[model samples]
Target: MGSKLGAAVAAVVLALPLLVGAGVAGIGSALFGGSGTSSLNCTPDGTTTGTVPGMTAEQMINAATIVAVGKQMGVPEPGWVVAIAAALQESKLRNLHYGDRDSLGLFQQRPSMGWGSPQQITTPTYAATKFFEHLTATPNWQTMSVNDAAQTVQGSGFPHAYAQHEDKARAVVAAVSGVRCQPTMAGTGDCNNIQAPNPAAMTAINYACGQRGLPYVWGGNGPLNGDAGFDCSGLTKAAYDAAGISLPRTAHTQYNAGPRVPDGSLLPGDLVFYGPPSKIRHVGLYLGNGKMLNAPTFGQPVQIDNYRYPGDDYAGATRPAEHHR
Candidate 1:
């Protein structure tokens, strides 16, 4: 991850896109809702009945893709609800080609279930659909616990486990519902670059980037950067912290801190940088459109700049592997 960041930051002299999408033009996230903030107010369906707990990067992508595939295949809400719970329990939404004694896919489906070839069963969408199909064939699955409904389709070693993940599954379904999965630069980038981030997310990125042009001083991030201002690394840390993430002190240390974001996979508010040895040098919050907000140097107001510009140096970038606590 450090090496990758170094390579990206070293090439700060490229030309990036001049356009700004404002992201409001795309899907939008609603943050809070329900009678008492119980609703996630999802970026997709508008009202999330449950919540997706913070997960690993792998978990996030798998959950997102699977939900997207479900909706794409016209699988109904109950089917999705059941599938979500099953996957949440089975592998924490992680895609695994091998399962205990050949039980595989989201529902731990078996070849005996007429699920599909091994290849298809491993595919998130195909596997989820097959599980739902069996669920529909069972009697009274709609009213059953997510686990009970899933067990009807898959007789697993631990039948009750799925119940524990129901709320988590619902959260994923709501977040990824209807809205298509966009490829991420991380293994999750829109596989075909067909997706864009939600609008509130865009605004969040803008909020982070709009902070650029601010003076960079040692320890100057104020509430985050410290009272003195900020060093190159301090500036980056400050922006992300304001966006709801606390980070390590140095740029070099920050580089290896969390999930590695692949080139072009960066989202707004993503931490990007420049420097050697895979360490963080200068830091900025990505605002998409090939732009980001950076403090840069002394006496400069944190300002948004184009990643493709020749003057700004960039190393690599990172976003929260999952949601921040």
Candidate 2:
């Protein structure tokens, strides 16, 4: 995603030694490509735009748009960092009418290459979403270095360019999203300061959290049925079951059996359901700060991810603790 405009600067910078190693390859892929298995130590601490230095108002707005799009798409803060860094390297965070060859917009995607029509590629929201779609498709992209991740998506001639912007990208993401993310040794970042779960709901939350990294199996229940993995509803059902509450076997049935919580009032331990009301396809245990613990899909593990994403069919949430109370 590095723009030709930034390539010259990147070449000069790449002459200096870089401290970051190559991102690990061959890890199993997830919906967004990172291992959400580990807990993040970051929190939505509050936005601080002044902390990001030397950007014009337009640039800042574009940067915020990128972050906002990432959030809307249920991308994690790390993904936001990659998107911002890619944007910074590509067009310096400016939505432009032109780039190298047919390239256009923030990431310099090209209409001729099927990134989109010229109009769609130039639009900030459309551009960011397209970038994330490619990014999340890259295997182990979440663990890739900024340069590597961006290059994987952009196929840039200047492959090393994006790394130079990583620090600034992290800063931009924090400034815009109010979430401070610290990269972990495992090549993932942890978020902290999530609101505490209701005391009565802790057992369920703890049970679900403890099952991170288990495989996702269709109609499978963890251990209770001698299966090593869990499907979405199976995880939630087992989690609540550990808390002395019984839940129905399937996602739709589970939603029907609810003491439903309203939107914007989701507490930790709420069972967040997705898909239409008549055909809820997935469920996750809410873990606050927009994260949820669930068995996402085949090949993905039980892990934490943003509960909401662009075009995700989010049904609603239910409080099993309240139901039993």
Top-scoring candidate (lDDT): 2
Measured by TM-score, how close is model 2 to the native structure?
0.47
In Å, residue 267's CA in model 2 sits off its true spot by 18
Q: Which lDDT tens digits does candidate 1 get at residues 194-282? A: 12233333334534444444566665655442454556666666555554666787777877785677775665546777876454566
- TM values, all candidates: 0.43, 0.47
Residues 197-278 of candidate 2: C-alpha lDDT, one tens digit per residue: 2234556777787888999999989977899999999999999899888999999999999989866666667889998898
Q: Which numbered prediction scores highest in TM-score against the true structure?
A: 2
Q: Name the regions of candidate 1 deviating beyond 4 angstroms.
A: 1-66, 69-81, 84-213, 223-228, 311-313, 321-325
